[model samples]
Target: MADKKWMPRWFYQLASPRWCYEITGKLLPLFVIAAILLLVTGTVWALAFAPADYQQGNSFRIIYIHVPSSILAQSCYMLMAVAGAIGLIWKMKVADMVAKCCAPIGASIAVLSLATGAIWGKPTWGSWWVWDARLTSMLILFFLYLGIIALNSAIESERTAAQSTAVLALVGLVNIPIIKYSVDWWNTLHQPATFKLTERPAMPAEMWVPLLVMVIGFYCFFAVAMMLRLRNEIIQRERRSSWVRDLIAG
Candidate 1:
């Protein structure tokens, strides 16, 4: 017999929907607990403990929500596009399912970012909206997410829908960089990124620490949401499978 090929155990497990479902079930509770703890702690720390900005004062507190939502929106879209690409290249149904679940969550997060930005903008700029480069690009990203969701739902064939949405997601990947660099590339009203990997934060630790907590909490929340949606997708698509049937019966 020919020698068996070597593959990572996770690679094999990822190819199995049942394994994905089971593992997500095991992980979901932990993520949920972590999200709740982190979000609550962060919210309290941001609102009550953190010092107000010298410039924006109490209004700056909205950063706790806006910054995290904006970061998560972009991150979620990246994950969705990457998952879609995996589905396209590998023909993995689980990857497609994950990509599908990402759209709605990402869309909602994008909206939250925009809404909070508007609220923050009113005090900072004396206006609710601006035709700034970053804002425009972020709006475009939101539309791209909606387009993917609409395309997926409009197609009749599941495989065709997956393929089409995957292509759309891959094409839309260009917008992410535009959104990130818009402020720097153009004379925009939006401020530069507050947190950069290479430099110290613009704000004091008292402000940035809670923001960091909120960011981590948001990621945990996304994981919890994504896994819940993926689990539901697995059950719905695998309704006829023996394991799923047994699970339902039990």
Candidate 2:
């Protein structure tokens, strides 16, 4: 009771791998349902209802996939770095697991972003690839994700691997701002951001509303994917423990 008074209940609970696994298991279904509903609705609305771009026509429909993937990829890298920091500072196993899980998911999202961006470029820029600032920075971001994944996998010791990856991730923090400001700072072929906090959106309601929905759905999907991977990591890491053995036995 006295120990409980010193620490937040949820924070303490997170230290327990079993608790984390069980809670994530309960939350997984809800995330899946929300992801499916939101994604399907947003996709249909964007593809069928949203008016085509005056400049790009049907090719612009790819923005629904491109923008969300790009946003999620960047966001996921930030989450991974934070998780790595937590694990490094507090030696939290769950945090390390989360950092590990983030790599593949984030990398996949980055790949999707690049693919969609290239496809969007073909019609708008008249090419499949170019070394433009935004595009180059985004490519670098993808390489950074891949580097973290490789670094983590190459190390043998779990603690050492986590620490190494944490340092690498922290260093990669410099790239995030670069990716965000590349278009504004350089003469890039890629367009400026469509959504801005300080300024009104460049797009009207009919175009941006479905995009908003898709962004939210993509975030939900990322959460679902991350939680699933974290749960699996917990099971694998804790397999020799009594609770895990009991869980398996049951």
User: For residues 1-250, what per-residue lDDT tens digits would candidate 2 score against the true structure?
Assistant: 1345667789867878999999999999999999999999999999999999998888999999999999999999999999999888778899988999999999999999999999999989999999998888889889989999999889999889999998998899888999899899988888999788899888889999999999999999999999999989999999999999999999
Clashing pairs in 2: none
Displacement of residue 239 (Cα, Å) in model 2 is: 0.5
TM-score of 1: 0.97
- Candidate 2 Cα outliers beyond 4 Å, as residue runs: 1-7
Candidate 2: how many backbone clashes? 0
Which candidate should be chosen as best, given lDDT against the real structure? 1
Best by TM-score: 1
After TM-score superposition, what is the CA distance of residue 122 in candidate 2 from its true location, in Å?
0.6
| Count of clashes, each model | 0, 0
